[model samples]
Target chain A: MATSTPTPDTPAGPTPTEARHRRIGELFWSSDPNELRPWEERFTLSATLLLLLLLLGSPATVPTTLLAVTGLVARDLLHRTWFWMAVAATFPLGLLRMSWLAWDNHHFLLLYWIVAIAITRLAAEPDEQLRRSARLLLGLTFLFATLWKLGTPDFRSGEFFAYLTVSDPRIANVLVALGLQDGTVVPTLAAELRQLEPGADAALPIAPGVWRVAELLAWATIAVEGAIAALYLAPLTSRWRWLRDAALVAFVLVTYPVAPVSGFGWLLVSMGLMATSLTGRRRTTLYLGAFLAIAVFTERNAVRNAIEQVLSLLPGVG
Target chain B: MGAIGRFTGLVAPLALVLVAVLQVWGVTQHDLSQWKGGGFGMFSTVDANANRVLDVRLVTEEGAFPLTPAELVGVAPQGTGRFVSGTLTLPTDDRLDRIAELAERSAWYLDEQGAATSDPSSASPQLEVQAVEVTVYRPVPDRADQRLRFEPIAHRRLESPA
Candidate 1:
């Protein structure tokens, strides 16, 4: 009895396929088959442009900026055919600026977008794929980083952070709080340091509580990184998935205040929020605000000033 | 997405993961330096039984000018690229070629760092660097403080025009 009647087996609402198609249709932009929201496109372009500009302009020697600019123009302002050109060029351009690329641990985050852009050109439904790749990259990065840190005895002993706190200018402000300066002698390592010629090497004594601080920090780093890894690996149906992401956002806010890896935090924030569909709009917006806020506060010059201000408040250290 | 397109999307992440895995494997074998590409071996050498530090300087008729290895490669100071060390000496094919290459690079880094006044118009005496010297220092390994001694395990010298 084919009477133009719906089957009893039919669901009351739209089928899964219909719902997915409707969603994709809503996000469709341009004549291309790829499905990325207009906002996602704009955000990706802005992030790439800003990241390249900051990298190239600040250092003064990165010639890759010109390549990146060409790629950006070709991809965004030109035909869809040129999108592949932009994507193809980013890798070599990145290689040409290998010095900057290898400068920091977090620089690998930039490659996430580079690969995502390339995937967008190849896929019909690009947003999900792009976001999936990003999430996977972030997870992989954290997992490997966690493993690397775990493998290092120095890191486990907190000595690595101690060395960084003592030597690296980026986190040197912590010294002021220790009631010492960059080159003060640590009592424990003082004798060996004294054996060397006076000016040949600068050795500093760890502040009384620096080791404990470093130890806690080391453990905290491992913990947070592991949690982030779990976030990406968690099943889509897991009830606790959102908690892990919130923890990551909080970790970024708290840790970046001290270490202040500006670009690193910024990239993480952007990538962390890319799973908007899975994470939901409100949480994504929250992370975006957190990212922008952290980015603004951690501007290189601003970070230096903030460090200087904190140091000046210390007694006799100013 | 077509099956081929879907397959390509999968390839991107898999490729990244593969590279990362290969990098990790290479690092465990100590065959890869982990400097050029995204590798997870950063700080892996912190616990090395022995650590080597390279100190390079350009010696001139006037005085010695301190410079970093990165400067030798025409890059601004990036600290050390890796923990690995190699002996560079005269008559060694690759080492000599490297020295010659660096000599051809502009030494304006000295002027940029304000180590010397190289103004052509100024009447002040110019710092004329005559040769480059590289010294490698290794930790005693069993030392209590991990102090690096002044004695160098390897040294290289290359004469330059200026």
Candidate 2:
């Protein structure tokens, strides 16, 4: 309950606006050990950490690398408007140079989030602006994703996941362990698919069992993504508001482990963290856990390995 | 909030709209993959890089020879991989021109095996590239067989400078 009123020593003391600015600056830049940091401050730190992780993980283009090193050296620079403007500006420049060749969809997500954070820093009510922006962006992301999946015939027919299971080694391992396809089928199918000439009338054989599992996965993905989108876009006063955090956290936990794109997962969690109520300790803890979970998932196939270990313990399974 | 702050607040939402519009435009007009350019279409479609291929060939006075991986690496040493990737993602006229320009500017020679080489010392016969042809192929599932086939979605050919 801090007041923005000027004190009796107003002649010598800073004006209310200056005082407020200093307080906001302290919220971001201060490193006092004893001072209790609020959730907003903590959110900013988490976002900065997420940005640093992105810059480090991405191709070491000059601008991104320089931004990463500078932010690391002077951590406080992350709080500055000019610094974020440079950051927000760097992404488009990178996109122009790299174009579609190298950038993933999540790179665009990262850019949007960075832009939101940059704009938030310039606002009088940064926390409010950030929350609104985060919710809107997250909602739009899933909406577009769901729409794309629905529009694409391949996705609806489960061809995408079926092909991915046989092709992508990471996904193939998981599916193979789940008994969707025998271990031998992956390499053989993949080889045949690779060797098949473009526009050739030849079709690769897919086991009926694998096709069913892929269809199930495709539908499940749609359901979950659609649910998350609906929940995030729901009105603030609606009963659905409380469930947004749970849905997002669950999405992160379930999606990142198998997919293993931790940068995208981390960015989602950061946005979820921003959108949630700061007053709830449990919500904050849940987000922090999600962050750590993404790190663990990215560092190694912890969840997949653990699943495999469990499957090995089961009878007639390995 | 001041006017600038208010305007700044709108930037994120406006950008979201702009991205969605551009992504759709790309998908419909340029045959840009759904999974790229801020569409959030990742994991939604198999139409990504894995399903796309770029076939580049250098048409010389004698015959058309496939541009070897080595030649591609040699031409744009710094950005060869990305250049190839960019062409596959969205094979616009500009990107094709750039690729053709790179090939035309660099000197190519044929070795004893008649394979093109960028090195002068390996030259058995000097070769002049007449044009560069780049075709972008994408996998499209055949309805009858349910098997994926590569179809040439876009093709670009640029004549070399005299």
Candidate 3:
């Protein structure tokens, strides 16, 4: 075997502490070769504990703070980035678990808001890849949502009559118990075709030409969905962004009753889109808008309450 | 093979883990000869006293109906995860009993593909379902589901009941 060469500073060899520090520094913390030092055990332990909390699906404020401190320490010593990764990994889970208890998923607001910030910072990078990824994700979310909703016949048929009929049991119980969920005495939207007695149709009170408007809305939704699908591959230009934002808003405005909160998210997205359009700065403003929208909706539905409802329903789920 | 190959090897486990999580998302049980679906995932640990075991499957129909929820009350502090939720479709409970006995005797890793493999005590077992807490998961939201409530056990002994 070839003889090992010693550094000029230490002709014999590195001391135990030096060797250990060097090994640890090289293995875990930083990428720099000349520098070598063990990470503070407190930081390491905090990170480990935070990781454990994530696995256990019981992230708390204490663990969150510990992780933030760890990230700062890591930045100071390692010069490598892990702040976003730590947040991304642990935060979403914490919110999801909290949502499981609360019967709402508002906890996601905290994570999504931070995601917006990260997206803004990342938007500045010269590589065009993140921009592409963001574009794809936006399209994917809408497409999946569309496909999922479409796959449900009741959803497409606007037969939320079952849900609405049962929303208030005292009003609906007698009719539903009779197996007549449709509150209407007649299928006026069907057989008679919109012309009923002088009074407003309780199920649908529309303007004189509203049937045409309703039909147009259906086609408009389909076209907007198609546009969103195309926008994913379309160049990341200002015009496409405007169209996308407008289409999303239109979708929310149109699909008012199905999922009101999603529309709320689009409304906030619209404001940010407008701001981003005006300044063309694109990073901080976009994130702020997206997060603000998500936060607004989610907080309305607390995490713990949502989780409780979801979990409680799970035992006899079928 | 150098750093790249080593990097791929490291990533393999992570990829497997991610796929497993996705599988959890896609988890549905089929009633071998029976039929069903429509429940979310839940977990329960063995009280460790009864040494009881549960075998279950999560499944639903192709036309999975959207959940109609009621005013959600709240989430529970602790629930099932250590146990697999499944059912048996048999003329008798003998096979189920045998399977549960075998399952309790030694853990087996069963994937969605239905492939099972045995590992020694020292081996890192992937599927170690220990408890079977049979529960009713309410799928609709219009009504609040009733649960079998019990007082919290401070320190329940792990020994088997006579």
Candidate 4:
């Protein structure tokens, strides 16, 4: 085993404080290539596409168009320096002009902004250090999300997801197909909403089955988030790296469809994929392909809706 | 790596940590909501006590009409991101304010888009819309879809010029 002991070049080992910082750094920010695998160039490509789609989806504007084209060219040529510079520049541009209403644009912009900075650092630092930073970022995201959800009373009781399933049309459609919910129009709400009248307030009931599913989904979300947190933060999981990587992939698969924020999902998967070992060309290709499929699946609404429509047509589904 | 490169490697990780810390603080301040994308606390919590939906409608000089989300997006593309995302939850006071703002913004947009003068030669000339109102709805706990209750929560007039 390579020893932790210091050589004569440094007579004294790291001080307690320095050792703590180094240990924390190793756990969270070390980007050890040996610990995991080489991330494919495609991760950068996927990140670029996410940033591009965000610009495209924003209300048609000159700045958005310019930024999108710049990002596209940078990614196409696989120019990290140019890509990072463009991303760095877009942060303020996006903040100043992009509507605060479409806050996802801001979120995506912020996410890529961090990644671009980390990538630039990676060029100078050891790859492992950058990898560790990426892992730290991903880990903190999951950890904070889990904590926030846990702190919410509704999420604890599954009421949040329950309400979403009943109120959100997309989620309701899925629930209806699964026989967990019945899509009956609320006559009172409808009657109160006469086109030219002062609209009235209304309440709708949720089926017990739907509630049960909501509870399951709620717990599942917490579980997956908690698991992902552990995967990235804990060193113990490295011994059983396959399990950790599998959980990451599974988390992406199970959660992305329900939430369907493709850009964010791709960013997470790209960062998460680096945690797994890519020992062979074939394995890496398959891994990259699977993630790409997930990216496409989550991003494209028509594809998901078409699949849902076909599934809803099955016998016993209304 | 040169001196500049080495300096960047040290700075980058620290910057990321700072960003994460600030995001946590923002959440505590409620300055930001939902960590749905890859940043912080999105869809992590809901204000369950405030369980009411705000259905927005536009009030014109001619009459009041419902403003669907799609219409809002079409008219005020800039303000529709969170509005579209917020469809999954109960409408809050902040959200109502946003809707009112969008309605006011879109009122001018509608005029510019010639929505009112689609058939300008009609007997009753279409008048420009003036305000927006939100109809609030609450889910009847353990009740069916038909039993959901709703009422007008708030209304605001557009900032039309004299």
Candidate 5:
């Protein structure tokens, strides 16, 4: 019996190869290619109208800075790496007013964003340097985060004990009564903090048997965070990639929900995390999109306030 | 010494100046001179509300108002950018020391408490305990340094009680 050669493993139905081939078009890995389509031309129109309004109404700084950033981001989207880097580096110099920062360690600490931008600018080429700098950033952030929390008693415990006496008794009860809510309390660090400050409010009221659970979870975080720091340095170890990615997502969940929108530091962190997906191994677009949406909704007022203040600084604008 | 040595000498000061300028340009800049007790004070500015208020840069402790001796007399003070008229009184002798001591205090306090102790209706220079009185035009702008011109209004001193 003669056996016929089977067709290349096909789907259940006859698929149109030509249509499929044609549909597999050039990928816009970074920008939304949909932005170019004529159907959604309103963004372009609105942007143009806003540009005109900004030019006519606001002072030089407001309209000029907005125009510059918009132009630079647009230009860089095409192929202007050097121009992008230069503009990004010079942005804070032009846009930041000394009055905006709170006078303290925070004022200087916030300069890290500029430094990160400079590092990125200096090393931007063929995506390798960008990845390397991103790695460096990851390493620095994770290493410091772990080291700062691991040795200290406060890290595992979530500082709820110190915060127990607040007007909201539930949290205090969690800290004082439930022996650090099983989910809330990391076992090891809380135990350590309670040990250090025995009479202090850090002690969770519960059976001694339950305390080990907190300790176990705390050690896990330590191991995981340490692993992340190492994995960031180890570039070849892709196995722990999930851990690192999950930790970053977890970080967003924990930080953004709690960090105040009034603070620029946290916003910078969120922006950076989103920006990193550009060169990062972890594909994190949804989290970033959510952040952008939040900014457009919840924190829109603050953004509007900043834009208005900048506009008001102009000579003729009311 | 030699040609290279001459070149080195010529380049060092220039290099120092360049570094100083770069240092200034590199960081987030505050033009305010943070040097304690060194910066000059400015008197006040006209707000959008058209009210006159002090604009003391604690960093720079100079009155923004006209500071020149010529402007200290009964002349109209000009160019401080207060957008309002200010009466600047020049103190002499014991009063001069008093003015300096008062100015050494915080500018905000000094602003709420302005300089001239005596009103225009007060006695002339000889008996008048208060310093000289002259009009102030504008407070100083951030643009540049300025000094006011003062002219003597009266040569007579205040009369003593009979």
Candidate 6:
């Protein structure tokens, strides 16, 4: 290829802002589709896809839906700060219209992440801004969750999980299959609970083993969450940085199967993907695999069901 | 950077602080459930909608009777879920008033068999409601007897429209 010589009137090369814009454009509009992009570019693409999935999975009010659809139809708008700003602005309004109390924690997380993306896009160093925001957001999320659990008497006493194990069918199923609870106990307790009068002092019988199991689960949950929080919040050292990704991925893999909060799991994975570097192909693949796995887990309950099936095959098991 | 850009950079941090403050305010000032309002407190507490009990009743000259699931659906086809969930989270007067309004608007009445119906000409006796009462209760676990006791957190009563 023949290169054109720069004339006296021409500047030496692309200015810094032009180069930055070019890099951003190349991220979204690559000449070769298979060409590898930077981690920030990959994160932008992944997060956009995740946001679209969330919006479609739970359609917001008319304005929010229309704005999101507009962005989806015009893929080029995904990189624009104004597009995200409009979306973020309408997100909370949609939540308010639906009644904020009705929204789950993950819904709020989605809103914050959307706002974070919009704000970061406006920074001079968008990539660095995005990475820092993701790290802080993820760390704060786990930190607050842990602190809340620690502060709550019911949660700390293991009574919360004990009660949930009986009330929530998803958790009950896994606990039942694992021999932590009697299969017939939950149904019996549920029927009795339905008949209870308001303001009544009632004692529903529970299997002793369930309390023990709940205590174990409670501690394990705290340990895992606390570990992840500490790892993400700590100053990153080259040697220990890998632990953050490992802890996050492990949390997703282990928690989502039983918890069935696929939206939360997906959001966590998206944040993790954003914070991680693209130093290794394997790391990128792991994040992609995790994101897909969460979808599969949500749609099919594959991992939970598989565990149940395997346990049932054992002698004396359900 | 422009002024807008600098302000935009603060959005994420500011949002985090706002969420935390609101979450705590909700728990302390209002009786908002800890499981909600976006403090990232999911799976941290049992004080969620599932543990909240709504005691809804229709009061007539005949006396007060609890509203059955069917009656609730009949009275507020669209608003029932929203009202219940809202009351569970905040249990504010506004939500209670909405529930009262829905209960007054209900055309269905309890027949002689205690079943809900909209037909006034039915042979069975009809219970005409003069008022609506709603009480929201939350579960408190008792370790002494392995009991989950429901204590009333909020209550509201409104006379039905003439």
Best by TM-score: 6
- Residue by residue across A1-318, what tens digits does model 2's lDDT show? 243345686545567776665566555435431243455555555665566666745543688668867876676676678987887777677666665546787777777888888888888877667778888888888888998888888888888887777667778787677766667766786677656544453454566777778788889989889988888777767455768888889989888777868778888887887787644346556877888888787867566788789999999996
Candidate 3 structure quality by residue, lDDT tens digits, A40-109 = 2222222332333233233445555566556545544212235644565656554445322231211322
Candidate 6 off by > 4 Å:
A1-37, A60-77, A89-97, A301-318, B2-10, B59-62, B104-110, B113-131, B159-162
**Tens digit of per-residue lDDT, candidate 4, span B106-134:** 43323443343223344444456666666
**Residues A1-318, candidate 1, lDDT per residue (tens digit)?**
111235798546557785564455334212231344554543453344344433532322334455456545444432253554454454446544544323344555465455565655567766666667667766776777777778766677777777656555556665765555544433334455434432265334555477678778888888887787777756555566676567667878786766556666666666666643333345535765676667665675766788899999999987
Candidate 6 C-alpha lDDT tens digits along A48-99: 5556555655536777788777765666566677887887787777677777
Off by over 4 Å in 1: A1-81, A84-91, A97-107, A169-172, A178-202, A236-238, A276-281, A300-318, B25-36, B41-52, B56-97, B100-162
Q: Write the per-residue lDDT of candidate 6 for residues B4-85, one digit (tens) a residue.
A: 5544545775688688779988887878888888887778777786678887788887777787655676657676777677
For each prediction in turn, the share of the native Cα contacts (below 8 Å between chains A and B) that it retains comes to: 0.25, 0.64, 0.00, 0.36, 0.00, 0.69
Model 3 misplaced regions, further than 4 Å: A1-61, A65-80, A92-127, A161-226, A236-239, A249-278, A281-318, B1-162
Interface RMSD of each: 5.6, 2.2, 15.7, 5.6, 22.7, 2.0
Docking level for model 3: incorrect
Taking the candidates in order, what DockQ does each have?
A: 0.22, 0.45, 0.02, 0.26, 0.02, 0.56
Flag the better candidate by lDDT, 3 or 4. 4
For model 2, how big is the CA root-mean-square deviation? Answer: 8.3
Fraction of true A-B contacts recovered by candidate 5 = 0.00
In order of the candidates, what TM-score does chain B achieve? 0.44, 0.80, 0.21, 0.45, 0.21, 0.82
Candidate 5 matches the true fold with a TM-score of 0.37
Best by lDDT: 6
* All candidates: TM-score: 0.60, 0.77, 0.36, 0.59, 0.37, 0.81
Q: Which has the higher DockQ value, candidate number 4 or candidate number 6?
A: 6
Q: What C-alpha lDDT, on a 0 to 100 scale, does residue A13 get in candidate 6? A: 62
Q: In candidate 1, which residue pairs clash? A: A185-A205, A186-A205, B129-B162
Better of 4 and 6 by TM-score: 6
- The numbered model that scores best in DockQ is 6
Q: Judged by DockQ relative to the true structure, which candidate is superior, 5 or 6?
A: 6
Worst 10 residues of 6 chain B by lDDT: B1-10
